[model samples]
Structures are given as C-alpha cells and as structure tokens.
Target: MLLKNPQILYALFLLIIPVIVHLFQLRKFKKEQFTNVKFLKKVQLQTRKSSKIKKWLTLLARLLGLACIIFAFAQPYLPETSQSLKKKETVIYLDNSFSMQQKGKNGELLKNAIQSLLTALPEDYHFSLLTNDEIYKNTTKQELAKELQQINYSSNSPNFKTTYIKAKKVFSKHKNTLKKFVAISDFQEQNLKDLEFDAQLENTLIQLQPEKNFNISIDSVFVKDKNIENTTVQVNLSSSTATDQLFTVSLFDHHKLLAKSSVNFDDNTKANTTFSIPTSQDIKGVLAINDNSLQYDNSLYFSLQQNEKINVASISDAKDNFLKKIFNQDEFNLITTQSNQINYNKLSHQNLIILNELKSIPQGLANILSKHLENGGSLSIIPAETINEASYNRLFNALNLSRYQKKQTEELKITNINFSNIVFENVFNKKVRNFDYPKVNSHYYLNTGANQILSYNNGQPFLKQIKQVFLFTAAINKENSNFKQSPLIVPTFYNIAKQSLQLPQLYYVNENNNTIEVKVKLDKDNVIKIKDSSKTFIPLQQHFANKVNLTLQNEPKSAGNYSVIANDKTINLLSFNYNRRESKLNYANLSSYKHIKTQDSITNFFSQEINDNQMNFFWKWFVIFALLFLVIEFLFLKFLK
Candidate 1:
C-alpha cells in the first residue's frame, strides 16, 4: 500500500494544542467544614482516579480521530502481485486479412477473438485496437466498437514493416506512460517469417489454432490452345489429406451451368483436368471446387474476347519484290501504286498504309493522313533511300517527328527488339530476327515524343515512333542493301504494316456542350488528347491522373465518333458493349471459437488482484467510532454533574 498524498501527515501537530488546552483549563471549589474532611479525602481520591482515566480516554479518542482524517486525506491503493501484468494504455493489433476469414468452430476466428477481448475488459481499464486494415487511435469505447463492427476481411494485407513503423510513432507519443501491445492472428509461418517487429514494443503474440480440416482449391486456370476456335480451359486442384474424394467442377456462363464434371482426388494427391468450351461467343465463367477453403481463389473468374482482323495496304514500285513477298498472305490487302497513279484519299480507309521509297507525298496526301488519324486511323512512312532535306522535313513535320541531321551510310543490323503488348499480342507472336540494311545518307534521327522499339548494333533506333505513326528508314530496296533476301523481311514488313494500320476506338461525349466526363485507367507518362475537325490536338481544361471531367472548347455539330488512343494501342471496339453481372451474394456462416493464449514477461502495473487480510476500516466504521466517542464524552460529563 502507498499513500497518494503524504503531506496530510502534518495534521498530527494539532494533537499538541488539544492536549495543552486540556491541561491548562481548571475550576476552584469553596472551602468546606472540617467534619466533611474525611469523606472529602475519600471523594478526592476517587475523583483523581476518574479524572486520570477520563483524561487518557479523551486523548486516545482525539488521536484516533486525527489518524482517521489523515488516512482519508492520503488516498492509498494496493498493487498486483503477478509479474505478467499489462499497462493501462494497451494497444491491441488485430489481423483482418482475407486469411483471417477461415472458419473456426463458431465463426471467423478473428471475430471470436475480438468478442472475447471485449467481454474480458474491466470497467476502469481503457484500450485501443488496431488492425491490418487501418489503425484508430485515442478512440472511445463506442467509437472503437463501431469501427470493429465495420471491419471486413480484405484481399490486400498490410505490410508488417509499415504497420510496425506506424505503431512505433503512435507509441512514442506516450513514452511517459506504460505501454503494452497484443497481436491476435493465426500467425501462419509464411506471414510471420516476413514480419519485422519493432524492438521498442512491449508485445505478446497470440496464435489462434482452429480444428484442422481438408481443403481443395482451384490453383490456376488458363487457355491451352491459342489457335483452336474451341479452347481448352485447364484447372489444377490440390488437397491436404490423401483421402480419395469425389468432387464436382462446374463452369457457369452468366450463372447458368454450361458444363459439369465429376473427378476423384487420391488421398494426399494433386489433380489436373481440362474442359473444352467453344470460343464462338465471348465467354466469362469460373471453375469451382466443392471444398471449404478461401472463397476468392475457389472460383477463378476469366473473360475471353474475339481477335480483331487487321487490314494493311502497301505502296511500292512494281518491281519491289520485298514488299511483294511480305504481304503475299491473304490476310493482307497489298496495294501497289506508282508515283503518277497514286490516289492518297483511297488509302485513308485502310487500317495501315505504307509509303515505301517514296520521293514525295502527293499534293493533298500529308494533310489527308493527318485527317485520317484525327478520325482514328494509323499510318507508317518509310522515306526513300535518296531524298532531299526539304522533302524529309515535310513528312517528318506532318508526323510530329523532330528535326534531325543526316548521317553517312553504314551497315545497320537489328539487335534489340521490345516485346510490348502491341508487338506480342497484335503483331508477331514472339517471332522476330535480325536483318542488315544500309544506313541512309540523309535519314532523320528522332529526338523527342518518340519511342525506340528496335535498335541497331550501333545503338541507333532502327524502328521508332512519332505519335501513332511508325517509321522504319532502314534500306530495304535492292539498290541499298540485301535485306529483301533475308528471312526476317516478311515478318518485319508484316508487323510494321499491321501496327501502323490500327485505329483507336471512337469515344463520343453524350452531350457536346456540357462537361464531358471520361473514366479511364492511365499509368504515368501516358498522354490524353482531345481533337477537333481541323486535326488540332487540344489540351483539356483540367488534366487529372486517372478520371477526367472537362468542357470541350466547342460543341460538336453532330452526334458521331470521337477518337481516343493510349501508348499507340487501340482499345477493342467490341469491348465497348457494356456487360455487368448481377447476382445475389452468398455469405458463408460464422464458425465456432478458436482458443488462443498469449503470455508476456513484463509485469502488469494495472493488474487487479485481491490483497491479503490487513488492518483497514471502511468510512462507515470510522463514522460509528466517532459517534461512540461523543457518547462516552456525554456520559462522563453527566456523571461529573
């Protein structure tokens, strides 16, 4: 026991003043007859004995009253004897990751643990709760309870290192007070190994252990055959125990089961199965295993769309065999045009048009190509081997290519090739080879707003871009180099033409005069452009990172199509059809309670324990004692009278 206010001990000095008054106060009696001297002597002896006893009793009562008052003034409390006691400002860290949704006997193990912690809280004790989702600080009981109820398991788990750093900052604010941390979770070995705990935290980890049960989940699903119109969807399943179990795998199209198959898994074994689904129509479905596990991975959702057709047109001299061999396939519409008979307006409708070894674009062609792009078309330009600077600059400026100085002829070989989504998915399917071409005398090297896709041996860009248009200035004609004879000739020409012909999906604002709200997911360095009929790219009134809402400079005269392009890849036109799945949510029932116990080595200063028997009285007992002392004083006075 300890006194909260020890200064009250000075009240003992008041006892001396009471004692002095009692000693000084006296009364004188009149002289009596000699006959009564004997009786008076006997009475005097009795009176002296009574006086001594009463004096002592009065002093004892006063002392007792003073002691009681001092004890009351100095508030005292008992401490706990246990060593593993917690502090008053305890911080509880709860894991709310998706893994915590694993069912126990009663329900979610995390839910049960939280409920137990709430039930065990003492009225005088206060605590704060943090979770893997977010931390709440200095909150009231009602607020904490409401936040707890609002918490749901999330797929994204918080990084332990980040949480530890945040916890350190929060704990540092209360350095003067005792602090304790309690982490409640499954404590899976995988999750624990990556965690770095702060050395400053006085913490205890509680691992909840639920009953072990067998679980089988769909590990992965993918299309096996790329060319086959009817695709094979493969599913892989795994189980913990080696019991031969029969399970059903179902494929659903818009919640309707299109196909179902039953398979048996040998005890403690893995299985792989395939289901054939026709790729005729765009299909979205899932493969589900009939086992109790995490639901997110149980059913894998996928979407499949049809491939778009690519149209290409090539302009070359009648004797150009390289262009002839590359576009020989039926998929390409190879058009040859002489300098005199070339009609540039007809080339606008084609997805890709190539100007090979051209001295100059016809009078209205450059402006026409710009209008085609503004209307959502792609173009590729291959400058002639021998060309003047004025002619080269005319084509370069039209494609937004920066000005450059010409370099002497050198044997350039394709060395590095980039495999972007445009190249791998839309163009060549990872089949590209090196080819040598004679470096031109007056070819321009791009400086800005251009991405070098393929580089030569000397680190010069062999294939580069200027906005949506692609330019390949390397020698392909027989006069300059033997590139026409190489095996890479067909794939290189085919890929370049296909990429240039692609067009962006047209996006139209519902109301042209009003604010046009466009929702798109964009990464850094991506440019968004809005254009008018004159083919001028206009900057938006306000540019945002992700979502954009801006008023157009002018109202559109008619309801037609607007163009949108990103990183040179056109959005799939068919994907614009809006399709959303609406189904009733099926929530699993809560499981039973899981037992977890945690221990800490540090002592708990706020621990409540019953102290051993000690000499102590309640305030009521002291009041009764005071009343009894007053009664004794009254009886003594009456007797004296």
Candidate 2:
C-alpha cells in the first residue's frame, strides 16, 4: 500500500475532535421523587449503562469514518511493483523478424503485438522503439504509431543479448530516475539464450506471442553440378511437426514452371529433393513449397550464369601437335606462343596457362606467372623431354611447386583415377576396371605435396593437383606417354578450364556475410550496382586484380533474381533468399523471467491497469461512510432524547 498524496493525511488530526466531543457531552443529573425507590434505582442504572455503550459505539464509528475520509483524500493505492518511482522512460522492442510472421490468436504475431502496444501503452512514459534492423529513441506515441503501420518483416534477426545490450545503452542516456523495457516477440529459445539483464533496468517485461499452427519451410536450395545440360538442383525442406504429410514442391525459371515434385515427410524432421532443368543460358530460378501459413520461408530463389569461353595460353619451345589436337578452337581460344616470344600481358586474361614441354622457364616470366597464380589463376606444368633440371627447379622453387628429379626409365601404366573428383562427377556411368590404361615410359621422378588425380602402376603420381595448379609428371608426347591419346584427356583439361571461372553460389543469405565476389573487373569510372525488376541500387564495392567484391547493404529485401551490373553492362546474375533460422517455430519460456508478469489478452491488461485500478478511486465509498456515521450520531442525540 502507498499514498499518492501523503500530505492530505494531516487531516487525520481532525478525528480526535469527535472523541473529545463524546467525552465532554454528558446529560445533567436531575434528582426527582419516584413512586418505587428500588425500581427507579434499577431503571436509572440500566439506562446509564446502555447510554454509555451507545456513546462509545457512536464515537468509534465517527473516528473510523473521518480516518477513512482522510485516507481517501490521500489517494492510497496497492503497489503493483516494489519500485514506487514514477515511470519515465519505456523502451519497447518489437521483433519484426520473419519468425514473427507466425499467426497468433489475433493475427500475425508482429501485427498483433504492434496493435496491442498502440492501444494499451500508458501515455505518461516516453517510448523508444527498437526492431531487428533499426532503433528509434524518445519516440512520440503518434510517431511510433505511424512507424508501426510501415513496419514489415526483416530477414536479419538479432538475439536477445544484442537487443538487451542496445536497450541498456539507450536507457543509460536518459537522465530519468525510472526506466523500463518491454520486448514483444515470439521469444524463440535460440534467440533468447544467456541474456544479461541490467540492474539499472528497474522494470522489464517480455510479452510472448504464442504461435498457433505448425510451419513448413523450404530451408535451402542449391545447384549440385552446373556443368551438365540438365542441371540438378537440391532443395532442403523442414517441418515443425513430425507428423506424416505430403507436400508439393515446384521449380520455376524466369517465372515459368520447369518441374514439380511431391515429397512425403513421415516421422522425419527434414527431407531433401532434387529437380533437373535443361538450361544453357544464364537463368533465374525459384523453388517453392505449398506451405501457406508461413509464406516468407515457403519459397527460395536462385540463379545460374551461362558458361563462358575459357582462354587457354600454351607456351612451349614449339607448337606441340598433341596440345593442338586436345584444345579445340571451338571450346578453347588456344593461344600457342613460342617460349621466346611469349607475351606477358596475355597471361592476365587467360584462365589456364599451359607450360607445354618448356626447355627452361625464364626468371622474369616465372615471377609474373607466380603473381598470376596467386590471384586465382590456374597453371599446368608439362616438362620437356630433354629438360634442364637446374632451370626447371629454379622456376619450380620460385612458383612454390614441387621440383622435378632424375628421369626413370621404367614403363609405368596409369591405373588409378579419382572417381569422386568434381572433374569426373557425371563423366562415367560405372567404374572403370581392367581396361587398357594409358602407359608412360621414361617419366621424371618428382617430389609432390598434392592430391593424385591419376596414378601409375607403381603408385607414382601421374597427374597431381595443387592449389590452382595442375602437374603431369610424365611428358605428353605420343612416344613417351599415351596420355594425349587417351579418352580422359578431353574432359580432364576441358573441365579444368571451365572450373577456373569460379561458379557463383546458387543463392545468398542476408546475415553477417553480406559480401559477394564476382569474376568481373572494374575501373575507377565503373560502378558495381545490383538491380531487380522493381528496384536498383549501387552497392559498395572494391576491385581486385580480376574480380569485384560487392558489399550488399541490406539489399534484396525480398527473394528473387538480381543482376550484378558493371556500369551499364549486366556482368552477372545473383540469387538471394531469406535466412531459415526463424522457421524452427520454437518459443522461449516466459515464466523464467524473474520480475515478469504474464497476461493473455491486451483487454485484460488494460482492465487491470486502468479501469479497475488507481484512477478509478474508492474515495466515494469512504465519503459515503463518513456521512452515514454522522447521520447515525445525530439520530442517537436527537431522536433518542
């Protein structure tokens, strides 16, 4: 219990006046003769005793009534909180993340929370509005109401710790003595772990909006092998419940339906499905499931870029006939240059540079090739038959590749092939066995620290792959090694050139990683911009030697195909989708908060806080009691006499 105006309680001194009046007032004794002296004495004693009891009862009632009147004037109230200070600042965090899209009893959890805050918030306290993306301090009710109408779901989500830290900082700036924080969210348990509540925050309230229905979401979508004509897309799906159900999953390319499949989810939490689409050019795709309740995560978007021509630079003592036959002009722009007249500038544009049977590598050219390989370029080394070991080792040591040793005269047959390599992902239908493998004669012995793609019968590495560099220990001459005539030569070198163009990911999630690198060069005058059908904006970017790294600042708010444009040219296409963390549909236990109170309906909250509380005073009943006591006292004095 507490008093709003304790100074009015000084009127309680007036209660003593009633007791003094009762003590001072006394009936004067009148002596008179009676017919029966004994009967008169008995009657007089009974009357006096009854009179004293009535006077005391009336005096006690008057005193209590006056005290009640004084208490009413003081405006006493029951303390709802132990902290009696007036509320000055109220910070309200409204979770607008995609998880808030779940429907509650009222509607969507976010919208319901916003409406409740608008209607139930007290007008006395100044408010601060915080969301997943932005925070507004000292906001007016009208301004906040307007902002609430414009609020929508956000792809980014901040955990409770971050939100609480932000609120504590905002509260620290205020000079007010009393402060409070109210967080309105579905309170997903994952986002509410290990939160530190500041002691300065006197009052903290977490309003939990309960979700009614389970949700099914398309967790992710990606492309496995983009090289084939029929590209296979993998779609990962998740459900909130473990019940058995059938759902339709569909795929779309440029708004046209490409494939549709049905998935059966029985007692499983997650499932994955694959769909194939025949595409050759750069195309935009969307993967969707028939989950209507939570529409935000039901669909995902992705894109695939067209295959570009690979520029292959072949430097050798002479134009080797085997190399010319392997790198066809249609697929590869094979620039065969003699070792003496090799143009260094052409190395910058070439995806894969071949050192085909070089007698010796020049020091100046070796340094340039080292720099090229460092900047994500690929190199293939094939030693000459009459090789100078010292010159080759000098270049090999400088380029950080393994050095060639003395030549071995033994005839070695290539037997082992790495079947799981991406280079041979879809190349073979069944495993190769005792077929006629390629043979190498008089191959060089080399020190290697790389994975062996092809091995000889004696377990020596025939073909090795280092980081961005490939090496063949055996020379690819028709007489020395039959590798040039083997069937594996076409796909092995061709795929290496194709893979040199770093394939962009199928889609991006809007999280801490907001940067995406594209294989396109830019100048000072050129700018990297992202655009969709509806909107366009220039993103912050930095230029590397051959690629541009763009930082997406809260871009692609909705999922769809986006174009990465360099100046006026559309350099590449990108896909974006919402983060799937919110699809878990798990909620935090609100009862765990120390000083928290829970109420189901906003109406009940207002009824208890406003209509049935302090503002609706009980003072009128006390005033009536005071008047009734005075009336009873008057009746005892006037009518009884």
Candidate 3:
C-alpha cells in the first residue's frame, strides 16, 4: 500500500488529542448525605460498574473513528506487480510493404495482427502508429486504424536507416519522458540487420514471416534496325533460381500475338532471345515473360514507324562530287541545279534544301526558304569556300542568327555530344578520330530561342538549333581548309541531313512532372484524337504550326504500360516504374526487447506515477465511519440515562 499524498499522513498526530481528552475527563461529585447505607451499597456498586463499562466503550469507538479518518486522509492504494510503472509515450511502427499482403489461413496477416493488438491495449494507454508508407504521431486509435485500411502495397519502400534516424529526432524533443517503440514487419534477408537503435528509445522489434517462392522476370529489351526491311528485338530474362527452368516468351502488336517461343536457362544464367518484327506493318506492342518480381519490367513496349524521305536540291558552281555521293543515300532524293536556274517554288515540296558552297544566295531564294520554314519546313545552310559578309548575313538573318563573328582555327576536337536528342540517335556509333574541320572563319551565334546541340572544345557551336531548324556552319570543301577530309566529315554531313529530314511518328513523354508539351509535325492541318481506357477521344487543340501541349493530369494510379495517341500517329507510349528497394518487407528483429521494462511488468497496474490529481475518496469513508461512531455514542448515552 502506498499513499498518493504522503504529507497528509501527519494527520495521524490528531489521535493524541483524542487520547488526551479521554484521559482528562472531569467528573462532578455531589456532596450528598449517605442515607440508607444498606440499600445504597448495593445500588452504588451496580451503577459504578455500568458507568465504567459505558465510558470505556464510548472512548474505544471515538479512537477507532479518529484513526480511520487519519488513515483515509493519507489516500492509500495497492501497487501492481506484473509490469513496471509507465510514465512515457509509446510509438508503434507497423510495416505496410507489399510483403505484408501475404495471407494466412484465415485472412490477411496484418489484419489479424492489429486485432490482437486492439484486444491487449490498455484503456488509458496512449500510442502513435508508424508505417513503412509514412509515420503518424500523436494520433488516436480510430484515426490510425482508418489510415491503416487505406494503405496498400507500394513499389517504393521506406529506408529503415533513414526512418530510424527520424524517429530519434522525434523522441529527443521529448527527452524527459520514457519512449517505447515497437516495430512489426517481415524479416526478409535484405531487411535491416544489426541496426543500432537510438539509445534513448526503448524499442521492441517484431519480425513477421511470409511464404516465399522463386520468380523470373525480363530484365531488359532492345530493338535494333539496320534497314526498313529487317528489325530485330532482343529480350533478356533474369531469374532467381540456379536450376534449369523453362519459360515462354511472347510478342504482341496492339493486342495481336505475332509470335511465341520457349527457352530453357541454365542455373543462375541470363537467357537471351531475339524476335524479328515485320517492318511492313506499323508495329506497336509489348514483349512479355511470366515472372513475379515486378510487373512493370516484365513487359517491354516498342513501336516502329515508316521513315520519312527528304528531297535535297544542291546548287554549286562546280560539280561537288563528294556532296553528290553523300546525298545519294537511299533516304535522300538529291537534285543538282545551277544557283541562278534553281526554282524557288519547288523548294516548298522538299523537306530540306542545301546551298552547297554558293558565293551568294540568289535574290528571291532566301525569302522563299524563310517563308517555307516559317510554315513548318527544315533547312540546312553550308557556306561557300569564299563568301562575302553581306551574302552571309542575308542567309544568317533569315535563320534567326543573333551575331556572326569570325575566329581563327585552333587545334581542337569535338569531344562532347548530346545523346538524349533524337537527331543524333545512333548516327555516330564510332568516335571521329583525328577529324579536323575547317576553322570556322566566321560563325553565327544564337541567342534566345536557340539551343547549342554540339560544341567544340573552345565552346564554339559545332551544331546549333533554333526552333526546329538545324544549321551546320562548317566549310564543305577542302580548298578553304583540310576539314572536309577529316573523320568528322561523314558524321557531320550525315547528322545534319538526317535531323533536317526525319519526321517524328512516335513521341516519348519523358517529363518528371505530370504534364508534357508536344508539337505535332504533320504535312497537313488535321484533327488529332487522344484517348485513354474509357475510349473517349479528346480532340487536341491545334495551335498555329500544329503545336499543342498534352496535359497529363496526374500519374497513372498503377505502374504499368500507358499510351497516348494523336490521330493515326501514336504520340507517346511510356512505362511508369517506381523504385522497388522500398518494397522490401524485412523488419528489424525484436529479440533485444525481451528484457525491457514496460507497464505490464510493474507492481501497481492502475497506479500512475506522474498524475497526482486522482481522487482517493479515503476522507469520505472516514467521515462515514465517524458518523456511525457518533450514532452509537448517542444510543449508549440514552440507554445509560
């Protein structure tokens, strides 16, 4: 037994007052003649005995009442023995990873675990719930449970080390009180092991087990096309098991299965297979294999579109045999014409027009090409071996060049290339060794609304792009400099022509944020439709120049394949994948907490060490006892009278 207010125990000293009053009782003796001696002797003896017994009984009751009152004022209580006194907050960590989706014989494992905890939780106990998804502190039971039901398996999992460190900061803010942390999760091998908990937190870790099975998944897929007729896609599959296993691989184009094949893999080896896709049809679909690691990478989607052909009109004073050979490639339709005789109206029909080493651009030629590009056409301008400044500015001004300056040649190489741009995709597979280009005597620098695609060592623009037009300012002939014979000649010429001609039939939406802006490059003004699973076609607003920004509202709910289309052209098809490292279900071990003290290990189960305002009701009981003693005293006095 313990007293909540020990200071009140001093009231026990009041017992001495009762003892003194009883001892100092005064009796009045009346001086009366003792008559009738014989009769008086018998009566006097009986009265004395009765009076003594009554006085003693009354004193005893008074003492008993006083003692009860003093003891009641002290406010005593019994202590619990099963658990230690808890005077701090409790934080509970719950694992909500995908592995927690494992079902037991009855139902979901997490549901059963929470039900058990609800039954054992004390009525006055307060706690917070933490999860692998996120943490919620100082929340009520009902609120936490509601949040728990809303949690689903996520591809991205939380890092235990980072989470633990955050928890430590939360606990440190309330350092004066004791903290209890309990974590429940699956103990995967990859989960945190031997992690040192913050010394301040009294932590208990619980590891839950889930059934496991072997799985195989397609690691990657790549498409290689050397020509329009032959395109081969290679698929690579990775597995967990070492034993030989057979798996089926299937190829599909827009829900139509084109081919299927089976292959066996040796233990722990990556299996590779190739399938030839017919270029005759516009192929857009997925290649998939059966696996359970994750569904996003299980299937790969790819599309192939018809290559656009560009018409090239070359005007040169002399027969540019090298330029003719380069333009003779099957992709380009090359036409040779004299500078004065070239027809400007015919330039509108061609995707690109080349001015090869022309001393001067004809009077109406620059204006026609400018209007052609303003209406959505591409152009490449190569200066002549000897050019006047006035002719160069006339051409440069039409291309939106900000400033034109001349620089002497220096020993430099083109070392950096932008690979993300579509223009240079796979154009230069090998390095341009010992390639020296003519030292640009004069170069046009772009300001606003322009991006430098490639730069030389001295930061000079090797390849510059303004709006949709690409300009290559290098000299085309060897007379000005030996640059034409350099290794950079073929790549430089090939990239410039390829970028100016190729039309985008497919778009890849690679924005990190939700929305993307896309400009359509089409031959005519046509209505384009964008649709989703609902099959509702939204007519895209075609701003001038066939440019539109496709606004994707939010990320797709589930990570998988998604596509957006613009009329016959499939604008973009992208895969949404999340980091799987956070999906690991392994939990911290709980064995270290077996010896930690908790409320359940204390002697006084209901006694709170921190709260002192609890009502004892001891004084009320004492008052009742005192009233009962007074009643008995009154009854005895009446009987004696």
The candidate that achieves the highest lDDT relative to the unseen native structure: 2
Off by over 4 Å in 1: 4-35, 69-74, 81-89, 104-107, 140-142, 172-174, 188-195, 226-229, 236-246, 262-271, 305-358, 361-381, 398-408, 419-451, 465-469, 475-641
Query: For each candidate, what TM-score against the reference?
Result: 0.64, 0.64, 0.60
Model 3, 143-177: lDDT tens digits are: 56566556665544455665566666555365467
Name the candidate, 1 or 2, with the larger TM-score value: 1
Ranking by lDDT: 2, 3, 1
Using lDDT as the yardstick, the better of models 1 and 3 is: 3
Highest TM-score model number = 1
Q: Distance (Å) between predicted and true CA of 131, model 1?
A: 2.7
